[model samples]
Target: MIRFIITRLLNGVVLLFAVATIAFFLLYWGAGDIARQILGASASQETVDLKAEQLGLNEPVFSRYGEWLSNAIHGDLGASWFTNQPVTEAITSRMGVTLSIVIGTVILTAIVATILGVSAARYGGWRDRTLQVVSILGLAIPGFLIAIFLVRIFAIELGWLNATGYIDFTDSFTGWLKSVTLPIIALSIGAMAAVAQQVRGAVKDAMRQDWVRTLRSRGISENRVVYKHVLRNASGPALAILALQFVGLLGGAVIVEKVFAIPGIGQISVTATTQGDLPIVMGIVVFTAALVVVINLSIDLLLGFVNPKVRLS
Candidate 1:
């Protein structure tokens, strides 16, 4: 297990480096003159040239990339070209908001999806059909549309939540919940639907396995056999699917944050990208990649723990 973990972590580091390299070059070469964009069309040619020189845009792309990569390795992400703020500071400040939504939504998704899935599999009639239809609808509907509908019903019509605002958890827990509830729901529904269907299939397959029948033959209670043996064996695939959805939720948060006016990494990422702020944009990209790598590695480790066969690979 320790060897497996170390191997995964090493791979994650290499993956992050590749992501950083690709992101830096793409933004540097593809996005035309940052200095000109910052100064605008009205700025004189000489002024733009001087500004570019100041930003070291005059330096070779490889040279600048080397400096950025070296500094990043030493924990200096560099100051934003546009805001002049440290990239790390800007991202860390908004991390809380994004983390809150992502974590809350993941937990909610797992609980709801698991229950609905297991129930549908156990019953296997009208209840299962209803859940399947709902899951299909969830897959069909985009998250942004769900956000808009939620805002209209829960915020505007019912007045149960604020249509657009974020409350710091440090200020008040209740206020924070009120602020984030709609966004979480909007994000969770799609993930829940996907996981539920996958889980339902996994559970049904596990129950049909010879091992389950053998356990039942040993005089094990039906509930004990299903919960302890069937679900446990079935959980591996469901967990893998859930981990992927959690990553997807991070991307979806970008739209949800924009709709709700929440100041999160996603919102700032859009701002930085639009302004051609290389340092900040790179920071966001690398951070997002790191998040994905870590989540996947954690899931791998968890699966290895739950099913020893995974560690062999």
Candidate 2:
């Protein structure tokens, strides 16, 4: 188990490096004259040139990439070209808001998805078919569209909650939850549908196994047979999907955040891209990549506990 964990951790590190390299080059390729964007058209040519040099934009791509990587490793994500503040500080300040939304979405999605999944799997008739159709519809709709619809219905029309901005959970937990609730619901809708389908399928498959038949033949109570013998055996795949979806929720929350006007890492990334804020963009990318890598590693460890067979392999 220790060896397996170490191997997974190493693989996660490699994946994060690949993610960073790809994000860095992609941003570098798409962006144009960061200094010029920051200074605007009215800035003097000499001033722009000096700013560019200071930012290492005048250097070769390889050299700049190396410097960026080194600084990132040292916890210095460099200074934002637009805000002129340390990238780490800027991202850290906003990290709490993003984390709150992501965590809330994951929890809500998991609970709702599991209930619906178990219900559909156990019932497996008209109810199952109805849920399947609803899941398909959910999969078809984009998260941003759902966010917009939710904002319109709950925020604008009914005025049940605030539509924009965020409150710190520490300062006012109730207000923070109220503000983020709609966005969380929007982000979790698709995830719930997807997760429920996966869980239902897994449960159905587990129910067909010889052990389940054996339990049924022994005259075990149907409830015990389903919950203990079936659902427990089927949980491996559902748990794995849950872990992955939770990780994905971070990036998925971006569109939802924008729709609801909540400030988060996704919002910060969008702003940085529009303003050509290289440091901020890079910081967000690296931070998100690291988060995904860590989540993946944690999932791997969890799988070992969830199914000892996986660890044996």
User: Which lDDT values do the candidates have, in the order given?
Assistant: 0.91, 0.83
* Candidate 2 colliding pairs: none
* Off by more than 4 A, model 2: none
- Per residue, candidate 2 scores C-alpha lDDT tens digits across 20-100 of 898888888666777888788999999999988887777878888898889778888898887688999999888888898
**True-structure RMSD, every candidate:** 1.5, 1.8
lDDT of 1 by residue, 173-286 (tens): 989999999999999999999999988999999898898889989999998987777887888989999999988888899999999999998899889888888899889888
- The model with the greatest TM-score is 1
Per-residue lDDT for 295 in model 1?
A: 94
* Best candidate according to lDDT: 1
lDDT of 1 at 211: 81
| Candidate 2 similarity to native, TM-score | 0.93
What's the residue-level lDDT of 161 in candidate 1? 91
lDDT for model 1 comes to: 0.91
